[model samples]
Target: MKRALALVLSGLVMACAFGQGNPARGVRRPPKLQLFHEVNLSTFWHQAIIRQLAFSPDSQYVAVKLDPVLGTTELVIVEVLTGKKISTLRSPEYLGMSQNDRVQWLDNQVVFLGSYYRWNALSGERLADAPVVGWQAIFNQDRTQLATVENVLGTPSYLHVYDTKTWSDKKIYADGLSIGTIAWTSDDHLVMSVGVTRKSMGKTIAGHQIGRGPDVGPDVALLLFDPQSQQFIKSLWFPARARKTAKGIEWDISADLMLGISCFGSNSVTLSVNKILDGRTFDIKQFYSDQQVKSNSVAMVGGQACSADGRFLFIKDVDSWDGRHKASNSIIDLALSRQVASFPGGKEEIASSENGQFLAFGGKKGISIFLLNGE
Candidate 1:
């Protein structure tokens, strides 16, 4: 019995001594993240960053979001084979003024999913027809039936949907709460975040700008919306005491539709990748931590795109100083690990692949493609 106990103790010591290397060691010395391809897109878009990027259904063409400061926003489509600009779709007034122009490739044609009207971002020419009020855009698996949002003025502001094929629109609303943003699940079910307008006030303690002007809103809670049943079945609340206030939460349904990532915060952030199965949502995964990433690294929001295979995610990290925010991107593979890889010149907008190929958004130099390998 003594010899057996001694042998077990010796094995335990050997295991501890030979334990795997530090698991918490972050991306200090991230491996290669090699260069796959780089293209010199046009130099017109400066201070201009890529917002949303998508590959065509056939995976031959690439569509990128172009935000040229003080200029209109354009969606530039390039042929992946030739690295040549094939087509450009611009956003119309009220839509292109800011950098929220979202250009998505559904099938053969690219559609602006955010608002209805489309315009020439460079020439300032109106592309689409009149304004599509309360209309939200969502694409099908084959990129058909662009889902749209339509605002219905009532107790609970309703959202209507329009089919891209027939141009027919329909209203979808629940009981309470204002409909903020809408998205489609993997199974083609609709989901949304519903919340009330909550206001908060803070007095000027010293001589600082103490939370009053454009930075105050009600405790924006999160709600899950179902378009089929037309109801908000679940609710999640944001932290009301943050210093910066709430900007609402963004949702990304995983490829399996069993998980999602919700971005919620004002100053300090909680970027949580959650799991939802069997009608229950659980916060199973997380990416960046406020204390670790936010404090030391540059933080920028707006463009977040996952890979086609749903194994990787891209986040637009930016730096803001004088009311202007400049951005770059990075890719994080949730499958291999919750580790991130950086591109040269500090990195901004990112788009990745399941096979480890990725595109990093470069301001004037165009887009850079690389493999997301650590070594």
Candidate 2:
């Protein structure tokens, strides 16, 4: 018996030293995230920075949010294949393209899902009839519908819903309440953060700013909305004090829970796991920070995005930030609940193409596009 026990002990030590018992030790790391494209903002143009990015339906083009020039806010379009500046939608200060802004393409024209009117992507014209341009635009589970407020200044308050096939909408009362973050729940419901209103504030026209503010959370809370019927649902509240980051909130959802990354600053973020049924908060304030990456890494909230098919969520985290920033994106497989891979991550904004073939990231400096190893 003593001899046998000694042998077992030896085996255990060997296993510990060689990582024989751990499931993750021998697993292969994901392929390095390839650079699909890059926009260098270091030329004579000093004031311009990439605020956000959107890929066209066919993924042939990408829209850079706001200015290629500082004082002017234009919808800059770039061809994905050739990296050429194809066009600009002139200056429309309201077209922020931030996480809060939901503008999308429809009928070959730029329209938020809620089509009160449409903006032309090529012409740079804000046309009158959304009779196709449109979300300041948020999409539901299938991207079939979009939830947006009226874009035309002083237009009657309405929560617009575009069902892809037709328009389904209802007028709203609190349309002027600033929107911090907007997300979709598993039941196909809308979840968002309501912030202070601007009806009488500094800015004159203020309604199209939903999803652009900070998380109105000392505690994680949500103002639920039912789009099919166009009704505001009950507010759900939680106990976790929302950590302050910069701006924007990114969500990954399941049947009973939601994974929300609330951006506090460039360095601080919280991966708040919430109970779907009752709005309970499970704080992972140090989730990525305490992660086993180099220890000094930080995640950028704008870089947190899920694939359109909902299979994976990619988050950009920095490994180093001295002068030349070293960053990589962490791809989490939602169904399996594991970090399956890591890609490049330093870009300020990230968006996945409709077919998921390309991942795009944008920043003040410029934009970088990448592809998964196999693709």
Candidate 3:
């Protein structure tokens, strides 16, 4: 009887810690968030760093990748509601971007990096290593295909596409090097973060600069491409980084790779936003009070997330140069293009469910699953 009572008490404590407190008892505050599950890497590894937390399509589970500690990494999948460990995969080294590592899911199965390994979350079944492994993998909005872009010295980056279900390399493109990062347009076309120098029909193509970012190389532009024909479609130089909305994505433009008219005073930088619905552009121009002229560049917007109703847009922006690489997020009222709330972090590992119902924040200590109230 005593042991059973202790177990019951422990469960109650966990519920409250997850923000699932009873309203009658006043256990939670306003806009209470329910913790779906929790994961602290220190429990299994002597040292752990939260690298990324990606939720499955159905939002039933989350796949977490811990940074490679002393050269070994672990990927753990846990049930969102029950906090049950479905499976775990170990990688000999870091996968993709070491700092912002990620995991991709296909048809609910979790496909991770490490010896080209794949695991099924529901069955806990592990697939054999593939013939080849690609780095810097990204998925389309529909999640039907995955693309791996590989860059080599003195050569253009190559992109390898894999069918999500069969994990087969379906297409290969040589234009990957032109892309700093990639996204999908509203019409199922691929958009790339590339600059003035480009490739069209295996020849050099250049753009007459109407605008620029910092005054060095070419300002990174969102170049649209039709993967089916492997042809370049169009390019736009606004909205530094795009996320969920407008079906258009913005790419980060490093100061070194951007150019403008008077990189001298650098008083203010103008950023344009392309709205998908009505084809309108919103300009967000701000002055650089924190940095010198040489260091002042376009405030790079990194992450983009939209609320379920598309009323609110979340933008993560870094204002200055390396003097402070810190990122900040502002909740924007889309209709007004005004900032509603501001927060400190915009660089941490975060993931949202397909349905935009939940947002997961991964930290060094653990992962926290919070219900998205869109507030």
* Per-model lDDT: 0.46, 0.50, 0.51
Per-residue CA lDDT of candidate 2, range 1-375, in tens? 546644654554344445433346545433234565676543475645666667787776777765555465556677766567766665445444444454356544463323343567766667655442234455554567666654444332345566656655544554454444455554666655543344512322222223323443222344666776655656544333333445444231211123353221111122432111222222222333233433434433445655655555667654344644456556765434456776544556677677555677764467777653321
Residues 1-375, candidate 3: write the lDDT tens digits. Answer: 546644654575455555543345522222223454556655654545666667787777888777545666778887765666777777655563563235667657756553256677667677665544555566665666666656553345566666666777755554423445544433445545553333322333324343333343333455555667776655455433434546455344322222111101111111332122211221223222223222433224443445544455444455445465445555545445445566443245556666656666654466766655422
Regions more than 4 Å wrong, model 3: 1-38, 44-47, 96-101, 114-116, 130-133, 165-177, 195-220, 237-329, 333-336, 343-347
- What is candidate 1's lDDT per residue for 1-375, written digit by digit as tens? 546644654564345434534445442333344454566654564554555566565555566666645556667776544466776666554244343235555345534536565433323344555244554455544444445544443235556655666667566544434555555545444455444422213321112222343435333344445556555455444434433326455332221121122211100111332222112252334455433443434334534555544555556566666545454445555544454664444334554432233444544456665444332
Score candidate 3 by lDDT: 0.51
Question: Lowest summed lDDT over 10 consecutive residues: which window, candidate 3?
Answer: 259-268
Estimated TM-score for each candidate: 0.61, 0.58, 0.62
Q: On a 0 to 1 TM-score scale, where does candidate 2 land against the true structure?
A: 0.58
Root-mean-square deviation of every model: 14.3, 14.3, 10.7
Number of backbone clashes in candidate 3? 5
After superposition, candidate 1 runs with Cα above 4 Å error: 1-33, 43-52, 67-70, 90-100, 117-132, 140-155, 197-219, 238-284, 322-330, 333-337, 352-360, 371-375
Q: Which candidate's TM-score is highest?
A: 3
